[model samples]
Target: MVDQDIFDRLLQFRPSGAPVLSVYVGVDGGPSALRTKLESLVGEVLEQAEAEPSQALRRSLLSDVARVLDLAARGGPPEGSTVGIFACHRAGLYEEVVVPRRARDRAVVDATPYLRPLLAFLDESRRYCLVVLDRMQACLYELFMGELEGATIVVTPGKPGRPVGRDPSPAHRLFRETADVADEFIHATRAELLLVGGPEETVAAFLPFVPHHLRGRVAGTFAFDPRTMGPEQARCCAEAVVDRYERAEEASLVAEILDRVTTGGLGAAGIPWCLAAVNEEAVQFLLIDEEARASGSACDACGWLGLVGATCQRCGGPLRVTQDVIEEMGAAVIGASGRVEHVQAPTPLSQHSVAAFLRFDVPHSAAQVVG
Candidate 1:
């Protein structure tokens, strides 16, 4: 699992020691394909390394590449479909992270690891906590982007001889105690959604013990015998519920954004409004159509993005054309700690292709309609 410690070290790393070799490789099917991909990645790195004026540094970079290749050769069960390998033999830093999502394949020899792309890919998926529970036992696991992490078995808090004064039965006591553990896990992980899987009766009884605040986060529940259920089966069942929940949530978000836009509220619709709001750092929530695409120009010098502009209105720098300005807008919103929702089709969100709810009303506008 890619945890906070890894991020802390990577971000703080300086180039005083040796150049870090950061490799993002996709796992196709078998070992042969991985080998070919690694070879190509190393080849590309070597080609770039040739220009290095220092021979020792160049050789060290190659050694880093070989270290990654060796890791690939002595592979175990892959954690994610794609793997990010960072190695610097001289710096005594070598970490292999398997990622659930796929990102572009790239190899870089730099003082610091190229991490933005990896973090972006991870951001595409929301975090969820899955509890495979029964009256006797509860297994809590963290699920990121549908990938399951190891479970932490949480049994009832008390031991066999512990006092059970008011509890009617041991089974009832287990349900309440397990629910507390689940709540702690969810809060600690900041899980966006919660899923419970167990026999129907047990799930029904267990949910009542969940605090009202946490109960609101329950996405769905499914039937399973925790003793007999496997990880693959559990994922399949939970994913179906997640799919339904997300679809409904997206549609509702689009409806609210559109309603606000029409009523002269906080909302603003269409690409032009979105571009302006993002530039002003006023987007509290950005709603965009998943299939929408647009060609636009951006002022790289000032981090300004807009449609139909040859020169930056804010700065005199020449605007560069971007294939899809919607992506640029999304990235900007995420960077600002705002929410970005990609609304699905069969919704009114497609009319604007882009929209936003501003943090505060702009001087000249309460709500904007681009058409």
Candidate 2:
């Protein structure tokens, strides 16, 4: 999974002397199939670039390709549905990141690593903290991108000589300490949500002890015993809650976007308006149906994107066809630090396939209407 520091590093990576190579393959058909797919996709890209006149580029590409093949052969294929391999041997940079989501199968030989697909996944993915509470102990775990880790324990805070914060009972003291630890983890990981687990009566009593700010982030609670439930079992518990929470959030967000579109607020629906919003850097939040697809054109010179255009609206440059411009638009929004979410279909956004909450109203001139 991609973290902020790693994402920032990838974003800032500069090639030493040769262009970078990035390949992403989904782990659908198991390890053997994953190996075959990686070889096929990367081979195709390398074959196309074989005739490039630059010796340095060829040597670097080949070296990185060798590294990838070696890793696939020796180290086991990554866990999860998608794996991203970024290599720039000349620059001494190589990274393999696996994510819980699925992405397109494509390889790019570019000046920097390709990151749009990963960025899109990260936009929908949120870090979660799970706290299983007990009267004298609280077990905290961090959940992200389908992985659960760090089963750290926070016990009642009355140190031998130190004065722990005054509390009415052992349960209250444990809850307070647990809240403090949860708050720290949330702040550290930038966790957008949280879930609590434990006895029913205990949880009912503990909710009030959570800080006001954290109370809002606590999506729900589960019942479990920290001693009996292992990490994997607890992960299953948290995953279910996170899944339900996100589905509900997506529905609510789509509804808001639809309402905003109708009321002339800061929102847009359908391909053309969303394309325009992204191109103009006015999208604050972008939402799209996962299965939606649209063919669009993009400007080569100025990088302006739209649903259909014979000539670039911004720079009058020649336009090129893109098979799926929704992906492009999502990448563009990410480039501008805007959030993009791929919502499951059957929601209100199914008809439009695309929507956005704008950062500011797009002017008439910048609006690229459908032809």
TM-score of every candidate relative to the true structure: 0.69, 0.76
Residue lDDT tens for model 2, 164-257: 5555576777787778778889998888888998877888988998899888899889887877777777888888887788878889999999
Sequence-dependent TM-score of model 1: 0.69
lDDT of 1 at 325: 74
The residue pairs in collision within model 1 are none
- Judged by lDDT, which candidate is best? 2
* Model 2 stretches astray by more than 4 angstroms: 3-23, 26-33, 36-71, 74-77, 86-96, 100-117, 156-168, 363-370
Q: For model 1, how does the per-residue alpha-carbon lDDT over 61-165 read when each residue is reduced to its tens digit? A: 878877777755787636437788887777877877777656677787755565655554544477788988877888888887767876878676435665688
Clashes of each: 0, 0
Model 1 spans with C-alpha error above 4 angstroms: 1-26, 34-80, 83-98, 102-125, 155-166, 344-346, 363-371
Q: What lDDT, from 0 to 1, does candidate 2 have? A: 0.78
lDDT of each: 0.75, 0.78
The CA root-mean-square deviation of candidate 1, after full C-alpha superposition on the true structure, stands at 6.9
Candidate 1 local distance difference test against the native: 0.75
